[model samples]
Each structure stands twice: as structure tokens, then as C-alpha cells.
Target: MFEWMAWTTPVVVFFTCIVLMLIAMTVWEIRSPTVMRKGLLPIATTRGDRLFIGLLTAAYINLLFVALGEKMMAWFGLEQEPSVWISFALSMLLLSIIMKKG
Candidate 1:
């Protein structure tokens, strides 16, 4: 099962972080309802909406990074593809920004 995936440590950690975020968000929503409001995002959105958007953004970021990893390594004359952790950190940072201001 799941053999098609490499199931790397970074991949596991990234998914674990997402799961934890969803749980935390669910609890936060129950504790305090959110109101639709405008932020850095063009449209007014609730916390849940922002989370969804953030999740999508993070996925795209990770995919893009992975797709370009080899090219990036070649461009930089590296011995191997860039670390997946770079994508994870970038995705998490963007997710935090989206959560706070999107």
C-alpha cells in the first residue's frame, strides 16, 4: 500500500503538519466563529475559506517545487536535486501568511 509514493520523511512530515493544522482550525472554529472579512486577498473570506485557499496554494507550491527540483539543481550545479524540505518550509510559510492575511 502506498508503494507508488516514496513516503519520504519530508513528505510524511508535510502531510502530518497539514493534518494537525486542520484539527487546530476545526477546534478554533468551534471556539470562536469567524466573520467574512477582507484581508490581503481581494475578496472577503471566512477563516475556513482562507484555510482552503491556503491549502491549495501550498499544494501548488510543493508540486511546482518538485517539478522543477531537477532543473533547479542543474542550474545551481548541485550534485543532487534540491531538498524536499525547502518546498515544505516554503509551503508552510506561505500557508501561515495566507492564514493570517488572506
Candidate 2:
């Protein structure tokens, strides 16, 4: 009852915060759906354009999350986590290469 809530409350709050942040990000991206559309004009006329566009959008969003998370951790003086940095670098590299041939 009350004893269980004492420990679970923090976990629930953490997840709730994450969900809220994700929702905010979604709204922000939807508001500016055109920025990530760059370099896709040539492929826009193709039948697979929509699919490609969606993939690129997903990549861009993931990259942003990784990059932003790293910055946030550093800004808050949190412990430097290797996995987070690795994910950030990997995301950036993949995004760079994927967006090249477009």
C-alpha cells in the first residue's frame, strides 16, 4: 500500500517524465516537418519517396536524442556513461553517411 508507493513513486515519475518529454519532442518535430526534408527533393518524385523520407526522419530524430542526451548529462554534471557516448557517435556517423547519397 503506502509502503509500496514510497519506492514505486520515483520510478513512475521518471517514466512519466520521459513520456512527457517524448510527446513534446513529437509535437516539435511535427511543427517543423520540412527541415528534415532537405536533400529529398530529387527523390520526392519516386514511388519510394515516402518510405525513404520516413526512414530519414527517424534517423534524424534518433541522432538528435543521442546528441542532446550527451549534452544534457554533461551539463548536469552526471557521470560520463560510455554507452551514451557510443550511441551518440554511432548515431551521428550513421546519419552523416545515410544522408550523403541523397
lDDT (C-alpha, whole model) for all candidates: 0.91, 0.56
lDDT computed for candidate 1: 0.91
lDDT of 1 by residue, 1-102 (tens): 898886899789869987998899889999998999999998999999998998899889999999999899889999999998899899989988998988
Q: Per-prediction count of colliding residue pairs?
A: 0, 0
Per-residue C-alpha lDDT of model 2 across residues 35-70, encoded as one tens digit per residue: 334453454322234334545665676666666776
Once all C-alphas are superposed, what RMSD does model 2 give against the true structure? 10.7
All candidates' TM-scores? 0.77, 0.28
Q: How does candidate 2 score on lDDT?
A: 0.56
* Candidate 2 displacement at residue 41 in angstroms: 26
lDDT at residue 54 of model 2 (Cα atoms): 43
